[model samples]
Target: MDYQFKLLRQSRQNLLRFTEQFTLEELNEVPEGFNNNIIWHMGHILVTQQLLCYKNAGVPCRISDEIINQFRKGTKPEALVPEEEVTFIRKRLTQTPSLLEEDFRNGLFGEYNEISTSFGNTISNIEEAVVFNNIHEGMHFGYLLALRRALTKTV
Candidate 1:
């Protein structure tokens, strides 16, 4: 497996563990002023991989636009996601790392337009984006962990 893809797989597992015990109310809470929830963070990571890895390469995203928009960067869940949908989203996210593995093994980047990342750096290649995504995923995972702590009194 490619280094980036492997890291992504590890990240996904960590996220799954973080959310595994949370309730719908916990996943839906906005925490007063915060604009994010556990569910949103989970979906965001998946959508980002799809966009940066697949859509940017001219491939169609396996997930829907509505789901992406609801969980994309800076998007907060305005309504609770159906439990079934959340389950499906998790499964979908689990598939992304392998998709990345295939793309990296082929050594094909296709055409990715340059885009400014949250770090104020521009990434124009698929490899760079993949690396960036891994880092960002970690950051969000940390947030998810923190959210888990905040939502659970026993934590």
Candidate 2:
């Protein structure tokens, strides 16, 4: 579990670095042929983690319902995310994992409901959800890389 948390932290750090290079416009730009943008991916990562780990466990999620509505699966960016909200998301990208670790250590997730992911995997426990989340985040990280490359080419 410690190793999983470590990987998650490192992955998010890489994401933060990937996002820091883009201006707000670039972060918000949905390049042709792409359904979403870099910041949307980042926000989705945050929202998905909360849903998978806390919400599925029958625990209250840390993020707002509005955030869940905006960034959850099947949702595209409806408007340009302000730099302020981006900043909040960036902070949570790091903070949420630490809080998750603490909550896990304290045994806050004793009742995870089995949930089927869009990727066809069924997560049956909090531990499995956390591990799956790392994979999910990595997938989005790849999307972020591809989006950045596309955005850069158009610049």
lDDT, model 1, position 141? 86
lDDT tens digits by residue: candidate 2, 72-118: 99999999999999999999998999999999999999987998888
**CA displacement after TM-score superposition, residue 66 of candidate 2 (Å):** 0.9
Name the candidate that leads on TM-score.
2
lDDT winner among the candidates? 2
Error of 1 at 4 (Å): 1.5
Local distance difference test, each candidate: 0.81, 0.95
Give per-model CA RMSD.
Answer: 2.0, 0.7
At residue 70, give the lDDT of candidate 2.
Answer: 96
Q: Candidate 1: which stretches are off by over 4 Å?
A: 153-155
Error of 2 at 131 (Å): 0.3
Residue 1 in model 2: lDDT: 98
Lowest lDDT 10-residue stretch of candidate 2: 111-120
